[model samples]
Target: MNFLIRTNWWKWLTMFLLTYTVVGGLLFTVPRLPILNETIRNLHFHVPMWFGMIILFAFSVFHSVKYLSSKDLVQDLFSKELINVGVLFGILGIITGMIWANFTWGEPWSNDPKQNAAAVALLIYFAYMILRGSLSDDHQKARISAIYNIFAFAVLIPLLFILPRLTDSLHPGSGGNPGFNAYDLDSNLRLVFYPAVVGWTFLGSWIAGIMIRVSLYQFKKDSE
Candidate 1:
């Protein structure tokens, strides 16, 4: 009972935080700024997607490194599950951001540097999946995919974080551009925003856990 209860605590927390974020994020009071206006409310939902993606990708690569070191198929499975969820989040982030941009900037594809970088990152992972599919040997697939995933994450850091700042970007907080009041949320947006990140990230983990279990079951059934 204790083991079950302890292992599942974060699942409960994920549910609670997401409920709070959904209820409060939609109805909560937010700063009224020019250009952003009420769209700033997207900060809670959209931004968290990227945060969740980053967190999941980092988790993915960590397990990938473990797989490389130990050659454990379980670790490789975990890594794949993490990247699957991470890519889902990344796709959601890009779509939502594009919608937000379309409303605010009058075009869905503004060729914004940040958006381009995000697209590139997603493409690299898509290539990773393709590479994985091409291999017939499980061990060889795991070894090569793990190495590719590590490199993808390494490039992702700069593409997602550094490169945007180095160039002129329409995204908030790039160069002289202030991010919708420059993180000075005055505690209004942060309340929901922080929880949104936590909620979405844990939710991704929960989904990944389900995928991992299913994969393990299939692996076991195949072995038997």
Candidate 2:
């Protein structure tokens, strides 16, 4: 795990997979579903962003738990940078989702259960950043933010995955709506979709890794 996080080889893989994802997503043949039709092509980019975001956030929470147990500022830094990249992916996911909604749902912003839930989830993380900024003591900031990070992820999982399903959500796999599985009867979408998820997730991790190394360097310099 540490080698995968710290090494540079997979960064090349991230680039290759993402390049393939973009080319294939834009030009690949997709199902000719009713409202989804050509828009179903968005499945490659849109769904992958959420998958990446969720993965990043899960990693952040893992580091946050590690920080709490070890009382290690480095673990706290890992949690912070992970959340930073995770939030970026979440924002991109929302933008892409809104674009898809405009094309398929006829509006950029509807009161869809999942949409609202996603927004709320982002706001919770936004508050996490705010909480970190509001503190001056490094240890205090790390300790509080680490706890908040764990709780934010707890809320995020239910908000994005569970609550939307319990209500009438327009999003696939939620409410009464059929997911990509139902539409992707031929397995064509999975080819690019799965790669897209891994590529985006790796890309986010790469960015977070860079930030972690930079922050650790600065921390060491300050301590010295």
Candidate 3:
């Protein structure tokens, strides 16, 4: 974690991959499927946003657990900032998904089970942020926020993965819908899709790292 905060290589790699994804995802040939046709290009951007969000949230929960055991304020800072960035990615994912849905599903929103579940999951995390802001003391805020972050993540997994699958969903891979794996047989898409995930995740981390550094500095300054 500390090393990533100061590293340059991964950041450079992120820029390169993102540039490639944007360029290739737009120009590259995609599988021509019924109804999907060209909108399948969204696969590069939309899916990666959620992938990055999940990764960021998982890291947030890990740091939340670390803060619980170690009682380190810095760990608490990491957890908080990670959620901040994770929520940002989640919102972007929703927006991009909506755009794709409008093109493919004939509407921006169809009350899809997974979409509702995702909205609920994000609200839970938003509540976590609100809960933190309502507190005054740093220690109390950190402790309570850490616990809430863990709980939010616990609820998040079920909301996103379990509840959505129990019913039908418009999203791929759930509710009797065949996943992209069925249509994305074109190796060309994978060439950019996989890197897009890594690139977006790294970009999120870079943003969170900046936030963490600023917050940490403020935290230390306020202590003195």
Candidate 4:
């Protein structure tokens, strides 16, 4: 009973928050500007995906660290599951961002620094997966994969943040638009934006949790 209740509570919250985000984001009052126009609503959808990806990847790294410390296969499984969901979120983020860019930026694949960095970051993690596939031994795979996870995350942080800031980019808080943050999002957008992040992250986590459980079950069954 307790287990069911605990699991259902966050699931309910994820649904509620996302429902509110979708409806409110489209219909709710937003600041009107020249370039952004109605597309500012993408904040509720597109941006959260990146946020969710970061959150999911952070958890993946956490589990990776744990795996290194304890050498537990379960930890490795959790880390892998998180990366899987993180990549899904990254793909969603990139697709949605391209759609948004086409309307506002006049080009879907403009050479935006931030976008380039994001693509590179995903590539880095994909490489980690490839590295895992190459190693059949579980112990070697776990240890090496965890190390790569940590390194990829370390590089990812700077690639997303520092590198973008150093170059001219269209993303907020970067490039020639030093004052972009001031004009980027107002309080009204934030009301939905913060919850959107939480909701999306929670939902990503829920999806990862489901994947982890199913995989673990399959592993157990195979073992038995």
The whole-model lDDT of each prediction reads 0.86, 0.85, 0.88, 0.86
The RMSD of every model to the true structure, in order and in angstroms, is 2.6, 1.6, 1.4, 2.7
> CA shift at 136, candidate 4, in angstroms?
0.9
Task: Tell me each candidate's TM-score.
Answer: 0.94, 0.95, 0.96, 0.93
Candidate 1: clashing pairs of residues = none
Residue-wise C-alpha lDDT for candidate 3, range 1-224, written one tens digit per residue: 67798778999999999999999999998888888898888888988888899999999999989988998899999999999999999999999999999988999989999789878878998899899999998889999999888887887888887778788666766644445565554799889899999999999999999999999999999889
Higher-scoring candidate on TM-score, 2 or 4: 2
TM-score of 4: 0.93
Model 4 worst lDDT window (10 residues): 1-10
Which tens-of-lDDT digit does each residue in 1-224 have in candidate 2? 25666578899999999999999888888878788789888888888788888888888888888888989898888888888888898899899999999998999999998889889988999999999999999989999999888888887877777778788767765645446565553567788888888999898888888888889899999989
User: Against the true structure, whose lDDT is highest?
Assistant: 3
Model 3 CA deviation exceeding 4 Å by range: 175-180
- Once all C-alphas are superposed, what RMSD does model 4 give against the true structure? 2.7
Clash count for each candidate, listed in order shown: 0, 0, 0, 0
Worst 10 residues of 3 by lDDT: 175-184
